[model samples]
Target: MKQWKPAASALLAFSLLLAGCSSEQDAVSKPPATQNKQEKPSQPANAAAGSETSKEIPDAVKKPLKIAAIVQLSIGTFSSQYAQGLKEQVNEFGGDVQIYNADNDLSKMASYVENAVSQKVDGILLDHGRADALAPSVKKAVEAGIPVVAFDSDLNIPGVTVIDQDDYSLAWNSLRTLAQDLNGKGEIVYVWVGGFTPMERRNVIYEAFKKRYPNIKEVARFGNASQNTALDTQSQMEALLQKYPNKGDIDAVFAPWDEFAKGAARAIKQAGRDEIKVYGIDLSDEDLQLIQEKNSPWTATAATDPADVAKLQVRFLYQKVAGEETPQIYSVQPHLVQKSALPEQKVSMNDIGKYVEGWGKSDAAISAWMETLSKEQKK
Candidate 1:
């Protein structure tokens, strides 16, 4: 399909340049859910869509459209894959894309947004940032006629389009499975974070879940970090285990993010508490392995294909940049994945496409738009 290959020299140069900007954060090199540079790159579900070249590539798409892709963190595999998708799609479409890693630094995020406006980039892709800090820059971009597409960002700007993983559904599906597994009666720990859009949305459901399952007691609550995520959470989980040492005291855990789930699972395993099950949101090749393991406490998760979401965000940006009518707010749906349903072997992002059907395809409008572009090629 559409091939987007980054220039080796340019990537290397960018890496070197970025090296000085922020200290290298430790990357959690674990799998069934995270990224490994050595693993084979899996084709996306919509790979076929890229095979046919448009006979008439839009002049806007043909010219190397400059894009400023900014992210909150690069330490985790999910975030990395998300960033990777944006870069690859832009490159494949013959566009110039520069990724700005904020390392989850709020001030840095603001700086990048302001810099993008100053640079007069054709478009800006804001990934997982706070709206309060980004509003001014976003307003500047809109005033300058620059399109900005936000993924999991809380920015409430008038012109910018906001896209997000259906956080409520992701939590509802996973928690429903957990409630069923527990027969709706158990003491569970709640691990969550505030400030991020996706987390905030999921929290809404978390509150609803508590109200619905009145018997499921939330004995404890926790949060996550933008750096050394898994490890930090694991350490936090260890402390939690110590506080609630009795097996019967903590029957289950609801860690909405995979990283938090992973940490909770690791802590449970280390404490030799196999009976306590952990449910989470988000999955990857790395995450699948953990679920497939014998006696693994991580029982289930809900997720969308991060790679697919990333690529789709880029496509949306392209369409908007080309004056296509897209929804002001686009939501990607998620699915529940239990441990029993996981493949024995580690699964890549490609394999996940089946579970999350139409992972990146937002609506019929997107497909119809593509069809129009295809017919234009013939004309």
Candidate 2:
């Protein structure tokens, strides 16, 4: 994408117009909500529209702000959707976001942050970067006076707002349903890897599940996130099925990431292991299609819309840039989706919320001026 740098004089004149403009239309603004792992998700307040008055557009956003989106990995449908949402939201601000994809290399991700700092971008958005590798660079960026917002990162620096899905619930929502389906007694293969913050948090819940259900034994455990995560997972799972080599040897497979779930579900289907059920976290159009396959082993999943997640990240970043107070941490609630809850026909993220409440909507970090900004973009 071409870089956009608007003149300072134009921004000054626009900011005055924004500060004087008033809107009678109200916008909804609410803190991010959390739901009990076992309960159905309640409707989130409509952040796209509502009854609360909104503040004027900040002077910081009057110009075409330059944003840098640094990511550790960008794989799967969710990743693509998230990027699309982020771009659309940033577009509303008449800004551009340059994505620096590290392709799963933490060290490379660090250098991208340093590069962004060198560019003196208006703001930085981080995704899935380790604190040890990324924190120092983040400090340098903060020292340079750039606002930062992180999603599913371990960076604990001051003046940084962190955002993530409720990983604990994402795990328990699927795990609990699996335990109930198996009556708390069955052989389960655990598909997981450590290092990523979301994976690590979800693993904590997995450990609790092992202790909670003593009878539900673990037969095999193996996973790795790579360039071809889904295909690699499928090959590994195929080998695992061979090792077990019996109908009852593996009763259920718990894959917290959709890629792993898709891999495991595909392997099970190929092996004719119809008895095994795959429970996973995160959902996408491809994943939903897999779940709806004839006698597909993949069943329940817990997730928020990947697009909505990106939308929130962009809003939070703008909030910081606008010099508004922002929560140090924000958690977007995850919802449980069972195969039985989906309609018989196909659907995509654009329509998932029609069947699942709160799947594709959020009100966190929304302000009245944002609605006006969005309309301005369309006009």
Predictions in order: lDDT: 0.71, 0.79
What TM-score number comes out for model 2? Answer: 0.86
Worst 10 residues of 1 by lDDT: 21-30
Backbone clash count, each prediction separately: 14, 0
TM-score of each: 0.80, 0.86
Which parts of model 1 are misplaced by more than 4 Å? Answer: 1-55, 353-379
Best by lDDT: 2
How many angstroms is residue 363 displaced in model 2 relative to the true structure, after the best TM-score fit? 1.1
Question: What's the C-alpha lDDT at position 40 in model 2?
Answer: 16
Model 1 Cα lDDT, one tens digit per residue, 120-231: 9999998888878888878989999898888887666655767667565677778888899999999999888887777876776677677778999999998777577788
TM-score of 1: 0.80
